[model samples]
Target: MKLTLTPSTIHPPFGRYAHGVKATGSGILVASGQLGIGPDGTVPADAEAQARICMDSIVAILREGGLTLGDVVRLNAFVTHHDYFAPYMAVRDEYLADLRQKPASTLVVAAGLSRPEFLVEIEATAVF
Candidate 1:
């Protein structure tokens, strides 16, 4: 697995994830849906905030599986707010901006996430 730092016009690196990442292997990690729970098990109150936390959780899961965002070949985003497009893109670009190759992704809107506070959840599939 390889990790890389990317540049972006989006948000700053939150220190929770690499700007971009890459992985190579016979197989890659398939991340389960991540939640908004914080490292200390705290859940943020707002939808957008929780979405960021979910992204943070996915980052940790990818690292454990020996991969990074660049290794992600696909992404599925489940969001609660239709108006969150820009916020989501800002955060998304922050992680993907410098990737040499970009993953295919789709966004979906749901009535809600696992928790009422979970604004969004991103599940990923990686190919190495």
Candidate 2:
């Protein structure tokens, strides 16, 4: 089982995530940051679509590791704009809503990413 923690010392988390997580399992999967590019190497213009693709990539990696989205203990998202948070979170919730253990998460608004067309990049850590 994984443990999610939110200490009283810190302010409450702003979104659907914990402040920390303690994972249990012998296997630990660390997924690289995944961009919005799809199989055809095309990125969508909308941040919501890009976020969905990024989550799909992350789920694929987790499956390859013999895990599921529920096994994720942490997620780090990099976005090009602060306004993208709502769209990104919408997609995130759509994907992660069924998870029994909510993961620790962080979203950073970067000045720019590797490619201008890429609106979001997401990375994850899981144990199972």
Candidate 3:
């Protein structure tokens, strides 16, 4: 079972996410950091495109574990530049829009990633 929490004492989450999640299940799925590489191994230069690809990759991986984004308890997003934040957030919101149980998420601007063309990388944890 999974419990999503949002205490009245604190301000509601700024975006599509929960304050926290409590899970009591045997399956704990941890996904590796996923880059924005496409099927042809091409990385898009634009932040929005890269963000979308990253989210798509995460969804595909979650399905392999018999879970969806709704089951994700946490997400860690890494971007190469701070300017990419808005675009990344937009894409993330689109992907998680329908999920009733959102995950706690953190976004950080990193100096670089494994590849220069990689604009964003997203990692996730899901319990189901």
Candidate 4:
């Protein structure tokens, strides 16, 4: 089982995510950061579209480990600029909307990603 924690001592999360998640299980899966580039080597120009692709890639990685989004406990996301935060969060919220317990999440604006064309990158940790 997993528990989402938000201590009253601290300010509430600014987005649709928990401050922390406690998972008690035997296995833990950590997926590498996924870039916005598609399998065909195409990168979308829109930040929202790139964010969606990043989330989709993370979903596929979780599935490969025989787990679903429900098993995810944490997510770390990076964007090339502050302007991309809203678009990235929109996509993240959409994909995780159905989850009963939101995962712990962090989004950072970095100077750049591995690729110049990539706008967003996402990584996930799951417990099962």
**Residues 5-107, model 1: lDDT tens digits:** 3323223343466534444454656666666666565776665676676577666667665667888888888878888766766777777888999899898
Stretches off by above 4 angstroms in model 4 are 1-26
List clashing residue pairs in candidate 2: none
lDDT of each: 0.68, 0.77, 0.76, 0.77
Q: Can you write out model 4's per-residue Cα lDDT over 9-37, one digit (the tens) per residue?
A: 33343457653444546577766677776
What C-alpha root-mean-square deviation, in Å, does candidate 1 show against the real structure?
8.1
Instruction: Name model 1 segments beyond 4 Å from true.
Output: 1-26
What TM-score number comes out for model 3? 0.78
Off by over 4 Å in 2: 1-26
Error of 1 at 94 (Å): 0.6
Clashes of 3: 0
Q: Model 3, range 1-128, lDDT digits (tens) per residue? A: 75454434323434576544445475676666777777666778898998887787677666655678998899999999989999999999998899987899999999998778888988888887
User: Which lDDT tens digits does candidate 2 get at residues 1-128?
Assistant: 55554444323434576534445564566766777877666778999999988888777666645678898889999999999999999999889888777999999999998778888988888876
